[model samples]
Target: MSPSLSIATTVSPASLAGTLVSNSKNVLCSLHWKNNDATKTNRNLKFRVCSVSGGYNTSVENVPFPRDYVELISQAKEAVELAMKDEKQLMEIEFPTSGLASVPGDGEGATEMTGSINMIREFCDRLLAPEKARTTRIFFPEANEVKFAQNTVFGGTYFKLDYLTKPSLFEDFGFFERVKMADRVKPEDELFLVAYPYFNVNEMLVVEELYKEAVVNTERKLIIFNGELDRIRSGYYPKFFYPKLAALTKTLLPKMETVYYIHNFKGQKGGVLFRCYPGPWQVLRRTRNKYICVHQQESMPSLKEVALDILASA
Candidate 1:
């Protein structure tokens, strides 16, 4: 199917996974480095997968098989748990749902989007106990996805599935009405997970509203899962067009902790900006089968600086 899709990533060797860019019927099974030569240094990585329809015959013994997405989700779940344990009420976990080669917020293509949905489901399974699941609310970008999740990833779970926005008839052309959190949030809900709010600009604004109304000055905690808040931080949406979104960089963002993050920069001098809570920010470059930290700092570095300076220099 589709010539067995392959892509590159800057994720660490232990958790390397390429973007699975097919429909829901396809499954990404097994990943192996294309370059087996130990002496030849490889800058870019190639991830190969077998689709479910492809019989899943590919095998890699000794080396981990099919742990790509699992490892990433596991690490992300740990980061979120650490953030909550540290008393962080507002937190973020941003990574490319697609492979590292793809830009975040451009669009979460169907394959990667489903990957994220499944990742969220597995993440919650590992993150919350059965009793805790009943008190947690998970918000999707729109009402339609909530229905999908109810039957798929979150099936049989008492955890609530809600939405941030509702699409109007003109939604296909980038128009959607924001859903108010006042009517959606329950008093029993102790935690909220907002998933992929960057689909529509209004979604994140609604997220800010959720924080102010339900999360603030309370024991409740909020985690933005794959929201792609960097679009606002990097000024991708012009301040003139999205002033409220731009304001979040100064207001809501500073209070939030990025518990886990992975942003890849691709070019002649390619590298990944990686961070996991309680760990320092790191700039990593791929050399053959391994990733070496080129630079690291305590504070988060701007994406622009990471691309132009850190990656360029490293």
Candidate 2:
């Protein structure tokens, strides 16, 4: 018999509040701007207000503006606009379902979600814009061809690109080696994109190194194309891996500016995006045991909801 599946969208008010409080205390501090008639003149203030109220954790105090306050506000506005535009594109894309018809944990279905390639392309295009060019970095461990194709299509300077022939997480690299690797990440690199991180999640030390880089370098954003949640829940992964991944996510949540968990579920028509904040630890714990069967539509969350949540947080 197939394992039972159910849509997971039961976030209580308490959970939302917890997330907001956590975000306000940790991530959204630098984005906060003093309210004034000058702010009223800024077109992006509305976006800032929505971000703060919805869950960004920005403060609305009467602090004085900095010397280059205008420039700062302009940069923030651009970031907000870029994030909004990207979120919209993510929602409208017709997420191809050709490869998602099989049941989870089935031999090929677990590793062959080729349909997500389109989504990754879209993400790469958006993140490679000239405005985001310098600060956006993408690491693709498995898809060198895709990266090369994107470089050909989008130009070589679109974003900083790196590929690992072997999964860094699985390699026998020690902590210092990992740290040395992490040191290559420039402080200006704000966005970190990891495409189709499959078995890499099992490499806890490598994952730790990545998160440690984010912590040491603040304002870093993590966007992961993770399709392994269902596989983990189905017991394809070792029992210890789930807890370790969850713990790492929790530990990093309080440090990184944003951690977007973009998942494409099998048998679902669209992708589901999650903002891992406040209580990603709790969320991951709940998701670890849930088996999403082919027939369980109600058990899965919709892509639209996930997109909206991302916009609100942005």
Which candidate ranks first by lDDT, i.e. highest? 1
Error of 2 at 167 (Å): 6.8
For candidate 2, report its TM-score: 0.41
- Give the TM-score of each candidate: 0.76, 0.41
Per-residue lDDT tens digits of candidate 1, residues 72-142?
66667766777788999999987777664456545646666676788788788878888999899999999
Residue-level lDDT of model 2, residues 240-275, one tens digit each, is 746765564346433323223324432223323322
Give lDDT for model 2.
0.37
Once fitted onto the true fold, the runs of candidate 2 whose alpha carbons sit more than 4 angstroms away are 1-117, 142-157, 164-180, 201-205, 215-217, 230-236, 240-314
User: Model 1 Cα RMSD, Å?
Assistant: 13.9
